[model samples]
Target: DRGAEMEWISQYPHEKEILLPPLVGFQAINTRVERKTLVVELRPSLNLKSPTIEEVIGKLKSSYLTLLDILKGSLQAEALVGPSEERTELHESKAKAAEELGLQRKAHEETNPRWFNNALNYQEASTAAFAIDAKMATKSILAEMKTSGAYTATFGGYQMHKLGLTGL
Candidate 1:
């Protein structure tokens, strides 16, 4: 049987305890290399992909206050007509801010794995220690949010369901 392969003749595969994090909600292992090491990854999964902060914020803003957006946009358009020097200074300030933000994001990304979301694991573990089902806790929170009614008005439904549980 293939079970013989589990005991490698060379280097032991489990010599290094690789922790497949609960992050990204691993649907399937896409790749396996057998030489001197083992590496696992989710090649093409939506859960593995994370929308940039800018993209998520933009999508949320667009989905939430759509009518207000049109009105505010028109107002901003009318207000955009300003003194040339003032506009030039504003443009320069925005450019500088954007550059700074880019540098900070780059630095953070160097140490992070596409926002792997290890924070949620802490709370889930804590709840588990207390004998609480994380799923039921999430449902309770969703029900409370629904009763508040703001979540339904914002993203329709199911948008916030698996947020903390999965990667994206």
Candidate 2:
């Protein structure tokens, strides 16, 4: 198994560039139809099993860290202009982002209270990932998003979804 996994990973590039989709101005936060685009790529040769709950939550959590990294990185780059203004802008930006994320969390909770509440470990990770995006993006309790570089997953359980995402 280790050999197979290594062989699989070795075939890919060591580094990748990820571009986060913009948090669509205002119209983006609320969707009348909770439709999402999930791209799935099957590797017949690999025949991988559905990602476990831990893997799903882990990947989702990493993505939050990635977003924060991007946010901090850009804010730092902008700070060179004026430290005070940058601080104000950073505070406002974070507040706006948090507000939109909270709205999104409420929407998802209405539809799938168990999954949304469970995967987010019952709290917004408020210290982290905007909250809703990770579980939704990962389809931790839903369906489909894949690429040769991305992962495929099955619907996860209420209990297991909490395993790898809490206290972090």
RMSD, each candidate, Å? 20.0, 26.0
Off by over 4 Å in 1: 1-87, 114-116, 120-168
Model 2 residue 7 distance off true place after TM-score fit, in angstroms: 22
Candidate 2, position 57, lDDT: 49
lDDT of 1 by residue, 1-168 (tens): 111233354367665333332223444555687897676765322343666566554542333234333333433443354665555433343344334434433444433332324556333423332221223344445555676975642322344444643422
Angstrom error of the Cα, residue 159, model 1: value is: 32
Q: What is the model-wide C-alpha lDDT for candidate 2?
A: 0.41
Q: How far is candidate 2 from the true structure (C-alpha RMSD, Å)?
A: 26.0
Error of 1 at 69 (Å): 21
What TM-score fits each model? 0.22, 0.25
Residue 28, model 1: Cα distance from true site in angstroms = 16
Candidate 2 lowest-lDDT run of ten: 19-28
